[model samples]
Target: MRIELVKGVNLNIIPSKQFKTTRIFISFIKSIESKKELAERALLANYLEMCSQNYPTQIDIARKLSQMYGASFGSSVDRRGNYQLINFSIDYIESKYLVGNEDLLSGVIEFLKEIIFNPLKVGENKNFDEETFTRQKNNTIT
Candidate 1:
């Protein structure tokens, strides 16, 4: 099922009972512009995946995931024809499978929202955290 949330934004759902996990994907697609822009997108994916204002470090993010029944969230960049896509995905075990029957779907969604929309900023400027920026830049380079 697919629904258009706005003019160009959409929400898609594909349900399956075969797997014990649920996956949510969000993507940003745009026409390929330049090599520099591609590099920036790659760096952005890395930075977004690693940290946020609420989860300040990789360790903090990992701990949160661990608490969420071993769920994992990540981001990546892909090229499709003339378009470049930056994708964010999260996969977690279904709440029904938990021993306590706890529902984690809402929590998972909130966590992703935090990572994507509440990134750690550097001071009052419109820049990503300096330490995280440098680290992700180096990681993307290698």
Candidate 2:
């Protein structure tokens, strides 16, 4: 099923019983107009993957994922022809597989929301946390 979350953004739901794991992928696509934008997108993707407002550090993210049965989450940037796509993905064990009635799917969705919409920022300033941003920038450079 495909849902238009907004004017240009879409949500696709593919239900399958074949696998014991559930994978969620969110992609941001934009027309490639300049090399600078591509570079910025790449850097932003890396930075977002590392930290968020709620998950302030890599360790925090790791602990959260560990709590969710070792769910794996990541982001990637790709270019296809004239368009560039930044994809954030997470794979987790289905709720039915858990021992209790834990709603892992809801937790996963909340985590994704935190990563995408609530990024870590410098205090009272409209900028990314400098340490995280600099690390990501250096990693991208090297």
Candidate 3:
């Protein structure tokens, strides 16, 4: 079932007894202003998907997800006509499939919130982690 939570936001619920995993996707859509903006937005998406204020490194984020039964986290940028979409997604095994009952949904939601709202930053400049930003930028350019 899919419901419109707001004017532009939606909630989708898919209950399946056949599958052992759950998946969540949160996406942002906007018009592309320029080539530079597109590149920057792509880099930003990569940086946020990889690290957050709580999980400041790739290893930290990976370990945290591993603790949650190997949940997968990622982001991607896509072009739809003249618009650009940035999507952040997570897929994880349900608690029913794990050894113990765990609230993986709550943890995943909290981590996603942190990634979207509290990205890893560097000093008072309010910029992303320098090395990460540079690396993502280079990756985007290539």
- For each candidate, the alpha-carbon lDDT, in order, equals 0.87, 0.89, 0.83
Clashes of each: 0, 0, 0
Mind sharing the TM-score for model 3?
A: 0.87
Comparison by TM-score, 2 against 3, better one: 2
Arrange candidates by lDDT, descending. Answer: 2, 1, 3
Ranking by TM-score: 2, 1, 3
* Residue-level lDDT for 83 in candidate 3: 91
Looking at candidate 1, the ten consecutive residues that score lowest on lDDT are 2-11
Winner by lDDT between candidate 3 and candidate 2: 2
The TM-score between candidate 1 and the true structure equals: 0.89
Specify the poorest-scoring 10-residue window by lDDT in model 2: 1-10
Best by TM-score: 2
What CA RMSD would you report for each candidate? Answer: 2.2, 1.9, 2.7
Structural similarity to truth (TM-score) of each candidate: 0.89, 0.91, 0.87
Report how far off residue 5 is in candidate 3 (Å). Answer: 12
**Model 3 alpha-carbon drift over 4 Å, by segment:** 1-11
After TM-score superposition, the amount by which residue 53's alpha carbon in candidate 3 deviates from its true location, in angstroms, is 0.9
Model 2 / residue 34 / CA error / Å: 0.8
